[model samples]
Target: MSRRILLVTTLLLAGCTSGTPTPTPTPPPVKSGFKLVAFDSCEQLTKDLKAAAKKSVGPWGFSGGMMRTFGAVPDGARSAASAGGTADKAAPAFSGTNVHEVGVDEPDIVKTDGKRIVTITGGSLRVIDAASHKATGQLPLDAWGDADLLLSGDRALVLTHQGGGDVLYDRKMPMRPAGAELILVDLTGAPRVISRYRGEGRLVDARQTGDTARVVLTSQPRITFPDRPAARDDDEDRIKANQRVIDRTSVDAWLPSWTVTTGDTTEQGKVACNDVRRPVTYSGRSMLTVLTFPLSAPKLDSGRPVSIVADGDTVYGTPTSLYVASDQRWRLDFFPGRDNRTVPQETDVFRFDVTGSEPPVYRAAGKVPGFLINQYALSEWDGHLRVATTDSAQQSSAVRVLKPDGETLTQVGEVDGLGKNERIYSVRFIGPRAYVVTFRQTDPLYSLDLSNPAAPRVTGELKITGFSAHLQPVGPDRLVGVGQEATEEGRRQGTQVSLFDVSDPAAPRRLAQHHVKNGYSEAEYDPHAILWWPDTKLFAVPVNEGLLALTVTDNGLTEAGQIAPRASAMQVRRNLVIGGELWTLYENGLQISRLSTLEPVTYLRL
Candidate 1:
């Protein structure tokens, strides 16, 4: 069937099948004098009684009879399976060396052939020997101010900023321009620069397929003008002239380009940036990129880039094509409505074959209604393309699974009763189910059953006590979630590292919890990145303050070490633990140290 027709049919089928009401099984008769009351009715009665008692006699006296009669029911008892049940275990302890003094921001580490490759912000890359836990070599580049890094094979592509107009709302303040560029770093031997592409935003993702690499760039232009109250008729011209100068100055303060290197070199043809202001996502073989407008201004005329993911030969570009083939074929997936409101809507997957073709053919696949494709990831489940999406609009932010053709977008299951405002931030497909980190209103780790992709359900959810920013799957039955707890005074206080047991996707429990110090008011306190080192059973926290590493065990987390950064900025991907050493990226440069010794081998000053 044609893609569009198939999508319509699939949506129809989903509506019909999903709406087919399951016959409510009749409850067995209650024993003796017991009577059943619906949860909603009980809740209402509780509210009313509380209000009445507040205005009547003593609080306990007024509701005593009601509580005695209904509150003791066995069904109302908090079960071990419930969110705050006592059966929930404490987080496990993390054990390992405590390495400190490594300065870096938003660091990502990967191991290859007994060597560790560490990429950090500020445009410096370091290589560490896994066995020795020491830095073997380092490479620095000029384009390293808040750059992103990706590793594919041996080639590293660095995206830097060039120049673009900036905006300011206050006339007294100056306007600044946006600048970005992309630089390719060859990491096979002595690190050297290869190709550089200039732009306004950042180079998000790069995909390597043989000799060609596709690089994606975003440009954001913001111009803010002064708004002065009506002045006296005599002063109108003077005010207008002052406003003009402010407008002109706002457009000139452009920062230098920021760039980093990745291991991708395959050249995939380039495509123009999408004009949409909202986040755009593209699904690749194993990576996904979520592009959002510039942080300073609206994406009306200037495009913005938000998030990017790079892994191996597959790269996904956001806000353009829902799916991009390595050959550059673009598949556009509509939000299933005409208004095109940026808030997520039901997604209709479409197919575009970009291989050896120009102006790729577009085909509709299927639709996933009630489930909005807010954010997604691509994973391999039994060799099939396992696409996972976070549907924030649904009561139970759903995770849908689809076939590689983008056909058959099925609601395999959902995480119900996650509270009204709770949302799933990231979804990771591990084994038979998918592990998701729910944030905001409900802080918990949920395991979803994707075995039956069309009807996936939340089999288990374990409250982790704090808000989570990211989750990393450590094993088939284990996951590490990084989050933060705020103090009673409303300050970002401590880092909460939670480990979950997903042996039963329907009954996950916290295995451990570790709270770290160094909560900074100026820093973005959100635990942005989490990495699990199986070699040492250690978990690392990449925060704005610096890198925090902890050792995990059956008991709980133990402070392994912490590296304080020279200065605090949002650590987009600041610190990483590679080959048993900590690699940190700072505004000054890159810092490399051994995880066990906490000794610095080299500080490649940027």
Candidate 2:
């Protein structure tokens, strides 16, 4: 949900070619503030759930169109389960002009160690040499059944979904959806799987810090609700029957079970129940398990899993904390339809302290009076967390500052009434500053000063013709934005890239803007898909079947040329500069080119 996908080009960065020494980023802090409750017995589980269901005012979107959008045990979940990677002298080298975030690392389809580039695509892992610009080795990722990988040192964690035959949603017949699996690969030479961590539930998302990875697994109880009748003669009987199922269910039945497979030996069972807990409000429809394992460890982590009975479908993370947020859009989209007096739908936010290598420890849970646009809407700074949200009920966008004290995430301050009648298009938090874009007709980029958690105030606002879905910090006061170009009446035209000068927080201005005709970009939503080299002022954005490389300067955006145009949908997935050479990674292969000329020098087919 956050722009939290992780990975990079020979991303092993010990021998960074930046010609400067940078200090190691501080790891996240470890804290266990509040405790969630798991079940010690089946009776308690059934009793608690009955109470929750009895008190719920509206129906939870467990199935139907909302399930198709938010309630699926998805094979494609978008949380970055990246390893907080450090460059080991002996590891491959990888570096980027500007890393994803100061405190969080986002994963990509391809990562490099500077000397070698590693890519996980189409159930295969490919390794390419930076100098040779050719595939050095390749390995299939089928062991994990089509997965995304996170890199740390020379180790890669492959995350995938397995099992669950056909059940997508619908709690009618008891059936489990595809679960999650983690595979460890050693990338010293040929990619080889060394270990596997198996768990129940579809992959929700994962975040890593330094050598540790926090993996999120989400699963739903196999509800035995009877099929809908063509014509119901007794509605009350069916309702009571469902209630009986809830009241008779055990916590074990609600908890997801996972297994560890090391070589040929395997161990499987439900995680310890004491480690699980539910929030104040719940559907009892889903359980979220947050697991942690060292990227460097060759053996499966024996640590007990930290689980929550949350209905979260989205997550965001910083080096210090990982946030799991659930949207009530389903609530708004389902039940009572949207209207003026629909009250306000709030987002439930949970904090997990990942500073420690152990699976995230429960820190706090809070609610904001709106739904988050994505992961970019969440950031952790100093000792507090900041959230950007779009409150449709209030007809406004706002940023809320939250402080985790013991078990509660108390709101310290807020700046609402932003983009009145519109919703948030994107959010980027940099240090004590937050940049928000909201669009309905004209796009307004609002800059807010967050230095004071107790009082956040908007310092500047710039109105433009388009909205930005992603924002990148180019300098201390400069930001590069990518999103859809639109007309004054809010008719979206194509992709747009804009450079904003924010040296004066009180008077932000757009230095330059560029548009891609009849085009759209993934980087607008997936920030990791962008390739930026500050040293050369070249930024690559994948559009359509190729890449749009541009020289972004204080003056304006200068088009270099399109790179690697393919006829298929598996076009350019990633672009990176390793060892000063530009490389584009596609699903089928990779292309290397001259950074200066933008000409293809070689192509390696996977």
Candidate 3:
């Protein structure tokens, strides 16, 4: 294959000499034709076998064993009854006139029509009347307990839990079968189950493409158990043994499968491979999935390589390709009598085509030397696939846009001026611009102009005191950044909501800021997710305590209402929907509220 390189001088605002330029280093050639050599001597054979044995035993002893023994079984292992378990009750009363509750526990709400909101909650599909703020009808699936839900248009996909959780630290438990079912729920009509399909592994995620829903599963490998305890008549020994059993068992193991639900029939097909990472819907017809494997053989005597680490696991899809940002390390092999192992240092981006017959057509992008691409976001615009990579090095925080072919990666811009320890947390594409949130020493929101696809330039920035946990774009030139703020004394003050205007690509200005008292003690205000309502201009903030809805106006943001499901406990808004109605989630069940009335919509039984 041929290669091309582009070098451009970056102009810093600090007023440095412009004429002097540094030469970019040429990337090393990709190695091919090197065959996997078989061990000939007894010493070589012993080394190879030992390495394989260690690789096999490490994961089994720790993660697989624990899952087999103590993890929840397929039928949902009942936890030893706790004193605080709550039971389902009749729907709560509605009080507030401007706000009403809608649904809870992983509620994904979408505006099916102007007056109706369709939601997926507690593994069921329901339609809510916008004006009445009440569930018009619902289709319940109590059989698939504790299922993960995903929605695309009028289709709802539920991934039923496979068998027990894996034993991560234990080594004595036997591997149990991990399985899940894919159920399709149609929400356009009376909300009924359209089709169902079964698979061998747990479902991790589901992507909807037209009438078909492709579910991603990771297959659980059978694990071996320890025959005897490591120590006899010792409490520590017993505890260790139990931990080993839990570690060895496969918990939530899933293999990839695609279920095509059309009309009244469902057909299931499996991906020809395993170790599926992230699956995403590319367009309206096909899906994109990422498959990853180790680039080098395991070493028995050495610890795991750190340079090639896998940190963030997110699958971003464009129209034609999928961008996966994986943690990778450069493994330097120094074996005597082996072919001098030096070129192509075993670290970099592995690009794959989504439409290829081989599925994952992986090819090296470029040498990210001494740095790993931690997190990335993919966007498709005007027939170009744009990738924004977050560099691992704190001092060299940069974003690169790569051509879909994976061969050409251009460094468009860098987030400079901040402290070396600052890191960019999230990146999202809004129209022809890319918005990035930087965290760590300094928290700021930045907007970059991608009008020239190959040469992205940063046009505007807004420095805020609080670090953003999540970001949602509201309109063409406006966005809402949500997170918590901390004082200079290292004390968390409260939750923060900030709105920015990016009408001018080169200069983004903060339009408003909202600070709400968290109510809980200083230590309990961790923010997780944020959602914006374009129609009502409301921001739904889910924190450690509960959910809060705030309205944004010309003056600023005002807390319209709040919901406290529990005190001082970690309650995540697994999902949020703000269409014609309002929905919040809890661990045990869901809470629905009406956005206009600020009252309880209805509490449906899970």
Q: CA lDDT, every prediction?
A: 0.38, 0.67, 0.40
Tens digits of lDDT, candidate 1, 108-203: 122122244444333466665444545566677675344444343455444443332322346454434444555555565776666544444423
Badly placed stretches (over 4 Å) of model 1 are 1-145, 150-154, 161-180, 185-193, 198-204, 207-212, 217-396, 404-418, 439-442, 486-493, 517-529, 564-585, 589-592, 597-606
How does each model score on TM-score?
Answer: 0.52, 0.85, 0.58
Misplaced by over 4 Å in model 2 are 1-42, 50-61, 64-84, 88-100, 143-146, 162-176, 232-238, 330-344
Ranking according to lDDT, highest score first: 2, 3, 1
Winner by lDDT: 2
| Segments of candidate 3 deviating more than 4 angstroms | 1-146, 151-155, 161-180, 186-204, 223-312, 319-321, 329-376, 382-396, 406-419, 459-461, 504-507, 519-529, 543-547, 561-606
- Top candidate (TM-score): 2
Q: Give the per-residue lDDT of model 3 (tens digit) for 1-606.
A: 000011111112221111111212222322211111223543433333333323333212323211110010000001111000121132221111010011101112222333444544554656765456567777777544345444444555555755654322234554455555655566666877766555544433322222222333334333343444334435344435534543443322112344544455555554432222221110011112332211111101111111111222223333234333322221112223322323331223444344411233443233232232122244556655445443334233444444433343333323233223454445556657777765553465777767765556666666656665445556567766666676643255676677777777767777887666653211111112344554566666655457767787654667877776654234634334434356554544456677775577775433
